[model samples]
Target: MPQTTVNLRSLFLLSPDVIFLNHGSFGACPREVFTEYQRWQLELEINPVEFLGRRSGELLLYARTALGKFLGARPQDLVFISNSTAGVNAIAKSLKLKPGDEVLSTDHEYGACDNTWELVCREQGATYVKAAIPLPFDSVSFCDRVWQKVTPRTRLIFFSHITSATAVPFPAQELCARARAARILTMVDGAHAPGLIDLDLEKLGADFYVGNCHKWLMAPKGSAFLYARESAQPLAQGLVTSWGYSERTALNADQEAYAGRETFERRHQWQGTRDIAAFLAVPAALEFRRKYGWERMRAECRTLAALTQERILAANGLAPVVSGDDILQMLAIPVPRAGAERLQKWLFNERRIEVPVTAFGDMAFVRISVQAYTTQAELDALVSALAEFYKDKGNS
Candidate 1:
């Protein structure tokens, strides 16, 4: 499959001393996208009130509209947030849970998000159940495993579109549909999904969906979105409620006030007046992806990612957690759990290799993030570092 060549390295403003292979954690922005982001920032500084207060509403509406159409969603259903964390927080805050009400999810969720649900459940008297889905999962089997956690008390099914540590793409549409049939609210944390995987938020059928534009979309940091289905929109009370409340009594009218999604839009949209430039940079990112024909680029990156996993694991000192066929843009290669921190530290402190050594349960993995700019030479260097580390330790 022939596609245009992309220099993934040229996109980042990172220093030359760093060999960044951790696109999965926080994505590297393209030079062009950064240019657009800075332009918006400058415009904001030029007239903060005019840019943020006066014109921002309409500008954001347009951005949301463009983003919604791209995601196969409605403008009203999508709103901007700092990141997927904030988006999920908005949903968690809005939900009213009883003492025994259960929120079912898998164990592979991001640590912070797990905390978010845990704390929220504690306060609301709801039970948060983490489904124990085993590794090396097929979609059907994974769904079956997670479904076992659902009971009569299960009010919500919180799932991830793509997991963080494992880098596995969950069968979210299947789970969302099943939850829909059961009349259970489903909130999907699509933190790594938007550009890395194909997205159709409307068709995904989750009651609440949140994604970050920064990851894989090449948008500036703090660009993210919260999408709520028309039905679930009522559950949102902004993480910090500023406006979208009754000016007079501060009482939310169940009868007179909009029992719908107005609360989510009004409250969450204006969260104590922060920088709006990042939000405005979203359109630029989208446009950049469109111009680059990101579908082709994504396929190419996945291929490179699979190859990197294969070559690295095939080496004597390297092993892998997941197979190449299942890998997306990121692959987790197993190394000595004891030496994991040392290897990572040595590579960064000595070799200037900017990669992440992630610890999962009892496993230590050298997680490499493959993007359009990743090259064979860099991959070779990473492999060499591992080989050298093992040889020096007399482990191989």
Candidate 2:
């Protein structure tokens, strides 16, 4: 009922004809931020050499400073990447995993990240161990369940701070603290945490962390960051060995003069000439959130997401995978185990509803993301469609 929540819908560029309930997949950028992104692109095209050659380092540093302040990390510890997947690949490939070594993670991880670890472990003869954390998650017992799988050969612990498939928020601080005591390296897939939840990378005690600004923070696409603890920086080299690599010493001294002094930035920041507009416009996204009182908007969206889940679950007669408090703006509601693809297409093609249908184990979920642009009527339409669709098959 907050006026800001209703009015905020107009600020985004998403189509008014469609009910977009999939902000979790890719965040919707505000008009202001998109304009800033374009301005940066224009500046880049105006003089390629001036922007990429002479001024990119300082411009990126300013952008990183803003992002670091937002993430509760130092600029020196963070570097811009395309997305969380890129960050995961960089770290996964960089870790020294011998045969019989293990990388421990939960079953609720993102699919791309899971594949990244699986490939790395496959190549090195290391094992990728997945802890099967049961549904209706209990935060108190979460760490205990994951810790039971740890062994002397366990080299790393990786889990999502907020899981993508199930939309559950894990207790990262407790798990990270436990991993630290056990002398196991910890890497967090925090793709959903940056804006949906508060993050203090320094205090979280994780050796490595990655967050997607393009998801919750409402930044332009291709904007994300990787934060490495000072101790862990040496272990995470760039996935693409570019001019940032130390052995590429022909340009290291000159690169250091302009690319800043930190090895983390030196290694990861410059990965061939690509669009840096998204990275540079991150400050504008932050400014838009601050200007529009996005905290209140996000809180309202959380309440809406919970209500949306309750309505869908009531229609399908299925239990939830996670409690309401465990999710923020995104809610994963269990749908009938019929055809998830059919239901998803039906909703989009027939009802003009935009939402994701995901299958986990034997269950199918309709993951709904309630953002500032979402409306009660839009959600009601989705609920009505689901009830009607399932009723046609006598499943509701």
Q: TM-score: which candidate is best?
A: 2
Question: What lDDT is obtained when candidate 1 is compared to the true structure?
Answer: 0.79
List lDDT for all candidates, in order: 0.79, 0.89
Q: How far out, in Å, is residue 369 in model 1? A: 0.9
- lDDT, candidate 2, equals 0.89
Q: Write the per-residue lDDT of candidate 2 for residues 1-396, one digit (tens) a residue.
A: 346534777889999988999999998999889999999999999998888877888899999999999988999899999999999999999998999999999999999999999999999999999998988778889999999999999999999999888888999999999999999999999998999988899999899999999998999999999999999999998878888765434342337574434488788988888899999999999998888888778888888888888888876778988875686788888898886768888899999998999877888899999887777998899989888888785543
Angstrom error of the Cα, residue 365, model 1: value is 1.7
Clash counts per candidate, in order, are 1, 0
Question: Candidate 1, 54: how far from true, in Å?
Answer: 2.0
Clashing pairs in 2: none
Candidate 2 RMSD computed on C-alpha atoms after optimal superposition onto the true structure = 2.0
Which portions of model 1 show Cα errors greater than 4 Å?
1-8, 247-263, 316-325, 394-396
